[model samples]
Target: MADILFQHEPLIRLGAFAGAFAAMALWELASPRRRQAIGRSVRWPGNLGVVVLDSLLVRLLFPTAAVGVALLAERHDWGLFAALSAPTWLAVVASVILLDLAIYLQHVMFHAVPALWRLHRMHHADLEFDTTTGVRFHPVEILLSMLLKLAAVAALGAPPVAVLVFEVVLNASSLFNHGNVRIPAGLDRALRWLVVTPDMHRVHHSVVPRETNSNFGFNLPWWDRLFGTYRAQPEAGHDAMTIGIEQFRDPRELRLDRMLLQPWRSDAGRYPIGRREPGG
Candidate 1:
């Protein structure tokens, strides 16, 4: 039962795939003009495929290293994995939060390293903010992130159940931030203190390079808020802010081939990718 549940958890989140689709479709209807201009341009199915590929690869390879590290760390008390202490539900919740914290660090590394930035930029290349856009990542970035988390999982000796829960929440949050669904002002403001919401994430995708550098937290917004990278659009609407690389404002450059090669292009006029953020 645990195996079956873990296997499909990626397909079922708090906001399931179907739910995210409905939310996005609703946003598309409500804000037809703004969404249609860029949001409509994205290919949803292709992005979903990326998620499937990345998830499967990690799940298959992840267990070996994760289990190995847990075994190695068991020798030392502080380095050992957490034993199941609370109810199953509580353990899972704790796992998800811990894993999200780990993700925050890995995200920062992607922006700080030039080589990694080249690949990670593919995620930022999307002009659209839709559910499926979350899965749009350079293959290299996905592999590196998986490895980083593997080490974290080992060092912390996180429980298996928690790991399972963490993967589901991580996948869901990825979709949440990238999705185009509208967030109500009051709730959005409140949620920002906990998880990284669509509003917080929208800033990370801004066309302006400076604003894009802030808000690197994955599942939690406080990571950014605490780290001092959090920035929200002031006095106005995310409605006015645009998504995509600063130089690659052109929608065509958002395609897979162009985004994959974005770093190589010397001309920001042609590509529009920006310099790395200070202390990124």
Candidate 2:
């Protein structure tokens, strides 16, 4: 079992990249704001490399933990392994939905918890919110998040099939939600009912603190709706809202070295000293 998983790791990783890349390419073609993103030379490699490294690191560090957890707590038992023979598509969809739900909780915690915010802020450090921006998380944040997700997978009893499917859905959605794409107004409104539409997600990455806090769900729109955290698109919405945390305004702050060392910098006197209240 472990051997099969290890052998397929590259293929699985590539599959995720393919999905994300397709969405990003399509979104770039459709969205007038493509230029707003950091641009391909920086965008493509940076986003791709970071996601791969982070995911691979997570997998290597926790070898089979996800699979083990899934096996032990799985509610349904088809056999000793519970190797259910459902269609792959079903497994994929189930996995995506479950993983996304877990992510929503983690995202909320990052904003609400002060210590987590210190690490998660690096994600918000981007001066822009584009497809590539979605993958620009701090390594520490990624590690911490993977640990939380390991627990979630165990609790949810997610199968390998589900994990595979979730990886694809996650990659694709992150690209779509973060891509500077503008879906047709009518289509976008309707789609947000089932999935996280770009319009809805754009609000989450808004420079305005109020806008930043809404729409944290990564895949479906259900959690945001159910939790009373949902925000509708602004009637007279600006196509471009400011992006990034105010504290990371300096040009040098974009550097990886600076980003890694950011928390240690005693800029406690900084205007946005810490995360201000959502609307602050």
Candidate 3:
């Protein structure tokens, strides 16, 4: 099963991405949670452009990605799980859990660190929250994230199957949780306990820094709850609260060129921790 999954990794990833994206997009059109702050024409192209670029660059730089690294580790008897002689199922489970935790922590660091936040803020700068917004990370940030995932896989000795499952699930979850579609309140309440739902993640995109800093988990909700960063809802209420950072509200900023240039632009004091107060 693992060998088959690994052999067809690219096809699996592409299919999952396409299916999830189409589902969320159709759901948004059917019953959008919020009126789009920017039209799909303006936002979708740029957001999509970044993901394309990131995918190309990552394939060029790390041909194998994290899954390949895991396979390599297994062959050489490298990494923690391999070294510990863990069972296959145990290693896979532990790998997924640990990888999710690592991502949660990495998200916190991106918001907390000034330099990294410059790259990461491009994601938060989307004038709206939707499925496309989930994929709108800067290429540099995406590259750095891939590097981090590779390192984590190496250290954990994660199974190749675990890495594939983690990647696919994380990708699908990002699209699902960042969607602008609405879920019934009762269902949302129960669903969020098991996974990070759209409502849960929307809080993290709130324009207010405090709300933006909360609910950083992409796949699992437990990390935020465990770390005391889980905010139930935006203080101003989800419908009334603004999305995007305070700094870049202009529609032109939503263009692919401007997004590519975001990291080098002035700080805008958009970062959450130890803010320097915009030219202070």
Query: How many residue pairs clash in all the candidates, one count each?
Result: 4, 0, 0
Highest TM-score, which number?
3
Q: Which parts of model 2 have CA positions greater than 4 angstroms off?
A: 1-6, 34-49, 65-96, 234-236, 266-280
TM-score of 3: 0.96
Candidate rank order under lDDT: 3, 2, 1
Candidate 3 segments whose C-alpha is farther than 4 A from its true place: 1-3, 268-270, 276-280
The alpha-carbon RMSD values of the candidates against the true structure, listed in the order shown, are: 4.8, 4.6, 2.0
Error of 2 at 145 (Å): 1.3
Better candidate by TM-score, 1 or 2 = 2
lDDT of 2 by residue, 47-140 (tens): 4566667767876887754554555545454322236554545655666676788899889888766667777777676776677777777778
Displacement of residue 222 (Cα, Å) in model 3 is: 0.4
TM-score of 2: 0.79
lDDT of 1 at 65: 38
- Report the C-alpha lDDT of model 3 over 1-280, residue by residue, as the tens digit: 6567678898999999999999999999999998875799989899999999989998899888888898888888889998899999999999999999999999999989889999999999999999999999998998999989999999998999999999999999999999999899999999999999999999999988888889999998999999999999999988998999987789999999999998899774856566644455
Candidate 1 residue pairs that clash: 81-157, 247-272, 248-271, 248-272
Candidate lDDT scores, in order, read 0.65, 0.68, 0.91
State the displacement of the C-alpha of residue 263, model 3, in Å, after optimal TM-score superposition: 0.6
